[model samples]
Target: MNDSVNRPADGAPISVVLAGGGTAGHVEPAMAVADALTALHPDVRITALGTARGLETRLVPERGYHLELITPVPLPRKPTGDLVRLPGRVRRAVRQTRHVFDDVAVDVVIGFGGYVALPAYLAARGGVRRRRVPVVIHEANATAGIANKVGARSAQRVLSAVPGSGLKDAEVIGVPVRAAITALDRAAQRAEARAAFGLPDDTPVLLVFGGSQGAASINRAVSAAAGELARSGVAVLHAYGAKNTLDLRTPEPGDPPYVAVPYLNRMDLAYAAADLAICRSGAMTVAEVSAVGLPAVYVPLPIGNGEQRLNALPVVNAGGGLLVDDADLTPRFVAEVADALLTDPPRLSAMTSAAAQVGHRDAAERVAAVALDIALSGRAARGRRR
Candidate 1:
């Protein structure tokens, strides 16, 4: 699919091409950066390149941006018979993106690390010979994913969500969180938020979420430990994800004093209401937790070459949260960590301070500034040539 138009002439609207998909982790950052650009430079035109197979087809358009679909083939983790098809798919995606660049006259390409992002990076480097459009990549996870690894060599600037990933030209700008999360006033909203979420005014609440889709291992462990946590005077708000809720038998009546929901549409309220959090260490999750200054116990997903562990390391090291491996996650362990964090006021306060320290709540604005600069610089160079 191709979505294209001439760049607006008002200050020569920087035509930005964002490529990433497959999950909310990848797509959300791209949107955050796009929103940042729109806020900083109203004339800047943003378009997204993604595959229909990924979540972008739904998410990008839903966010009021143009979505361009391209054919994407999964890269093999290990060499297999399907490996031969990889080259052909890559060629097709590259060709499609080339057409997209030509149609849109894209000035810069920003990639947020995913297989769907590869074509746009290749097109920016190989197909657009005249403009030399700047390519920027943001790696949101600790261990760089395969897409970012390939995109890095050609990227003009690399921005990392976590620090010291051994990537050159990398800046630790923190992951871009949604605008709503950044706008919250923790001290001002805490009391009212607690009441809104149906928790006692003074009860210490622990917010638990696996992710948008949720993690079964985390959900199971937290459910089993709910009673223990409640007995310690900690209230629980758990989002079990829609898919996992069916298999999770309901707690017996009058058991754990907690609220269980499949999803949370109002994360601002949830964050404001919580005293602490237990969550997966996805890049977006880390940013949101840090943005809101909530102490956390992070359980990184045990998959994809331990990428989640790498994402959580910075926050864990900074004393913002504790990282526990999935192998180590158990009902007893979950209860113990939750109890300790919620009950210890001094420790919880320290963690919140540390989290706030590392969080760059204005990262989206910074990213947008870079995008606008690249676009304006490209335009100036073109004018000089003419």
Candidate 2:
């Protein structure tokens, strides 16, 4: 895929459009690569394509990247009325996306499979009057989603978080996580991290959280066991969802602090403060937790195509962590499993080492390099055609 293509002239500016909006799982990876590209080539311009309904409406702007809004064409799971209208919805989104490409003079398109991606892919393949741009696809799930599967057909390069993602011959580059997570040193920052949360310095700490909005089942189960865990001298730093509530008996002066917050703005410090975690096994969550070498009892959400379970499988199989079913993650289960791991430092240490080994800390830079190459090559190809 890297066969020598024409190279853009020295100091020439390059532009890229990233199409991976909707959820944090898709947006975070896209942002990480965008950051990498900026760090590597200050002259590079980046734009993000997203729908108004997705998290990107806020997250993209918050990250200081320009976001272009497009009409969302949500694919219905069943043969509903929405499915019947899919073609026209797709046409409108594709048209809007093509306008963004023309306005930006986009050198290349890098997509992390989602509702916005299919339109972007089709737009990149310009019509008879327009020039087609190179396309790159990154599948961040264990199984390739429909949009990614379709994009891969014409993609110049295809990447995956794991093998067997159903995008045949795709390169395996672990999920792209921000430098903050990839560079975190849990052991070295443990003291300061604990102090930040008011957690005790000498006790085992268990961190509990759901995704951004929070998981109700996880909140109920973990909060129910909070008191029992505190009595056993285990400190808790729980980021209960901003939308969820936790009822807890106030800790006495001697009891290890149970610092409950609505959200965790500093996940690096959170990872540093805890020896283990009980959280949902979303793709980004797995990448971040495992990247920091923090052992976790991953509880995959019971819904969806079971992709969450697949996301954590390699880590669990590598002995870096354990996986428990959502239905089995009761209050008692949390208490027992957490106590067993926290009390056994040797086991925890082994698990930590395994987790770190499986984490591809350089994944962001690796993907960024390939994406930049594709952009430059496309520029080169265009120049030659001229």
Candidate 3:
């Protein structure tokens, strides 16, 4: 069977429509897949659709891709004043998507899951009564997000980052990580990464980050235990969100040797140098940590429908990491865990092995192949009609 259809004989580029954006969680994976598609098929044209409220306005352009903006409203739970306004917003977004499809002559729509994805899915499924377009949805979290839940119905194939999400017709493709992270040569790169970061080669490195925006609970917990962790011979690299940086106290002299930054622009190096990680369990973070086989002590964000906890479940269950609740995250607790993991060489090695076992290094390539296949299939079907 031809799993991925070959490129058109005319050498014309296949076109793709990508929908989903709001946070880096959604945008980053979409961009990764786009990059992979570009590499695989140099002639592929990628057009991204996102909302003005998302990071895509800056991110998409920075990556040298075209972006179309649409209006999106969050889904409401109860019959409130917001519910009355939702239909109008949804209708507007759907109309905008219809216009985009016509303008771009889109072949296939790939959704990464956000309010922006809803409209694309609706249009692809003929909800707007337009020409049918193939739809694909990728759910990165173990617990499906609202947008993915809606998009799944219209999706021909649903790809998940974690397995056993109970969604029918789903493939466990793992999460797409940036190319840099996936390409790193762990053994050869480790020492160089440590030297570039000005960290001692012999010190046990502990990478701490709470997503791009940073987590307040994690910041506080790490700060409180900085001294204790330092005494236990662990070097900490903390990426505190810009907004939360002011709230953290400057570590005094002789404390855990930490290099604190507002954000880490070079994540590959951070992962390369870390022997262990303490972080919130965002889907992307979990995937990155697992990709590099960096063992972690995960403290899932205790808010917003338990999505973070769900993201970490598979790793924890697989013995790739430890799960700690945010409410239970204390200075003493973090220090104890960090010390235990850092000091025990055999246990740390085992966790690292497990993490590597669960990582899908080819996720981006696989997802890109699926998108290209759908686009090629659509083109073939159109030719037959003629």
Using Cα atoms with residue i matched to residue i, what is each candidate's TM-score against the true structure? 0.92, 0.96, 0.94
Residue-wise C-alpha lDDT for candidate 1, range 1-386, written one tens digit per residue:
00111343344557899887888999999998888878776667788988878888888988899988888857788888768889999999888988888788898988887867888787787533544568888888877777888888988789988776657779989888779888888878888887777878777888989999988998888888876876777778888898877233455564444888899988899999898888998889988888888888899888777878888777788999899988789989988988877779999999999988877798777776776676666676677778
> TM-score of model 1 relative to the true fold?
0.92
lDDT value for candidate 3? Answer: 0.85
lDDT-based ranking = 2, 3, 1
Give RMSD to native, each candidate: 4.0, 2.0, 2.1
On residues 214-299, what C-alpha lDDT tens digit does candidate 2 reach at each position? 88888889888877897777888999889989888766677778888999999999999999999998989999999999999999
- Error at 39, model 1, angstroms: 0.3
Order of candidates by TM-score, top first?
Answer: 2, 3, 1
Candidate 1: C-alpha lDDT: 0.82
- Candidate 3 — worst ten consecutive residues by lDDT sum? 1-10
lDDT of 3 by residue, 284-352 (tens): 999988888889999998878787888888778888999999989999998999999899999999998
- Candidate 2 TM-score over all chains jointly: 0.96
The C-alpha lDDT values of all candidates are: 0.82, 0.90, 0.85
